[model samples]
Target: MTNMLVYFLGFLLLVFGRCRTSLGQYSSDQCSWKGSGLTHEGHTRDVEQVYLRCSQGSLEWLYPTGAIIVNLRPNTFSPAASRLSVCVKPAPESSGTNVYLDLNGWLRPLLREHEQAAGLVRCFGILEGALFIEAIPRADISRRVTAFQYELVSDELTGDRPSPAEACHLCNEDQLLLAVCTKDFVARGTVTSVREDTKENRTSINVDIHRLYRQKTQVFVPGGPRARRWSGSITMPRECALKVSDDDILFTGTLRFGEARMGCATRYGDFLRWYRRAQRLGTNPCHLDTD
Candidate 1:
């Protein structure tokens, strides 16, 4: 709308003060303006028109606040789709490919459903220059698999999303199930030599732990190729409650920054310390009440 543009121009005036020079910079349209919302009356596909001109990987998002967030990066899983960022796994596990729906697209709805970060209807932030809703989506995803996509046939997406309790790593029943229960968890005994699959038998108690104190920061500096040192018995837990298997586990017991973070020699010393005591995924320690 002309009026909206005028309002924006005024907003810019407030931000930048007066124009730099009084030369020929001002256009006839700028001299006198009236408010009018975007008029696409003659346009057949207006949405595609305005958005098509931007970069290939970017997405334009209009917020309720009259602000917009543009996604500067392409969707990692599918570059063709719009995305904020891909949660990648570390070195050894990095080779595996997995993807999750960007929370920027689905989080608000999910949180409103679960009442986690409610009252978030009016929230805004810039991620990579593009505006995005700052809300958490209930990403109960286990493995990377195409979401069950189809035109919405029902109008009931307004409440809590369907229960996403099933662990669905690897597109198979065995791995999926194993990723959930403690069954697949393993350990070795010098004496008993027992291989216990706690998968079939396990008990889970959601301990909403609030404060997991920062234990200690271990520096993984230059020590050559021997930088990584796992303590507290490092091995795939006999069973993983992580249903999303195919999707790379960015970090396991500890945080794992992607290669970018790995390659920066200058920052390795600093990052190493932060990595030593990074928090991990599990039940929320302090559940932020939404309702």
Candidate 2:
């Protein structure tokens, strides 16, 4: 596998060397880019460049041919740009292409054509440079599309992604306070279900939210038993072992690749006690509606 990857990298380098000087097309907007590969049929070595300057967006390449370098950047310039991470989730039907992170001339493979079919989300730092999408040569390109959604995630509150051992790290008081203020979603809920996704190596945590203090992008929708309250599922590392809790738990997490990911969470009762203490000391990072 290593030898094959190295050889492929060398091949891409040779192709990119010739295509680098060629003029490329840019997306119409900062959000999404859609293009067809038929244009590159006669010029098989043509490399198109696409720049998506948005926090989130999608890319679709119908009948993908040649190659495309997708440059993803945030719309706004802020200190958070340094902390920004990029995540891409391929469309389940995405095929006929291999994705790689191109840092200068170096190439790091992100997804193979078969792996993209699984539609798992992959993330990397913004400094990783643009995505190099190379189309596999085929005699017939029928119904094939290389499509994926991208999101720029700021790790302001999420110190590290909840992966493997990082997910098991308990948040300190300071981090906990920041999570409440900065996380994408916050709610008080009961753990209704816990399912393990062995393939993804992550666990799904369904929460029956009683009080959704705040949420971005309607992650929690009105559901569960008479449509009384909001409910949603959050993903976390299986190693975290977030079991079903009878007590109302304060759930705080972020949305990545359009999925909620678990962050700092504790029993609502425990949070209430800690919050009251911090309030008394006037050391709370931000204010929240306790009522």
Estimate TM-scores for all models.
0.20, 0.87
Q: 1-291 in candidate 1: lDDT tens per residue? A: 999999999999765432121111121322211111122222211221111111111111111111112232321324323232222111221111122223434433211212221211111111222222221222331221111101111111122122233221222322222222222111111111223335423222111111122112332222222233221212222232223222212221221121101101112223223333232333322221112
Measured by TM-score, how close is model 1 to the native structure?
Answer: 0.20
Over 114-225, each residue of candidate 2 has an lDDT whose tens digit, in order, gives: 9899987788888877899999999888878999998888754323345465667888777888899999999988998899999888799888998888988888899864
* Candidate lDDT values, in order: 0.22, 0.84
Question: Which segments of candidate 2 are over 4 A away from where they belong?
Answer: 1-22, 156-163
lDDT of 2 at 281: 99
- Where is model 1 more than 4 Å wrong at Cα? 1-66, 75-165, 168-229, 232-291
Total colliding residue pairs, candidate 1: 24
> Total clashing residue pairs per candidate?
24, 0
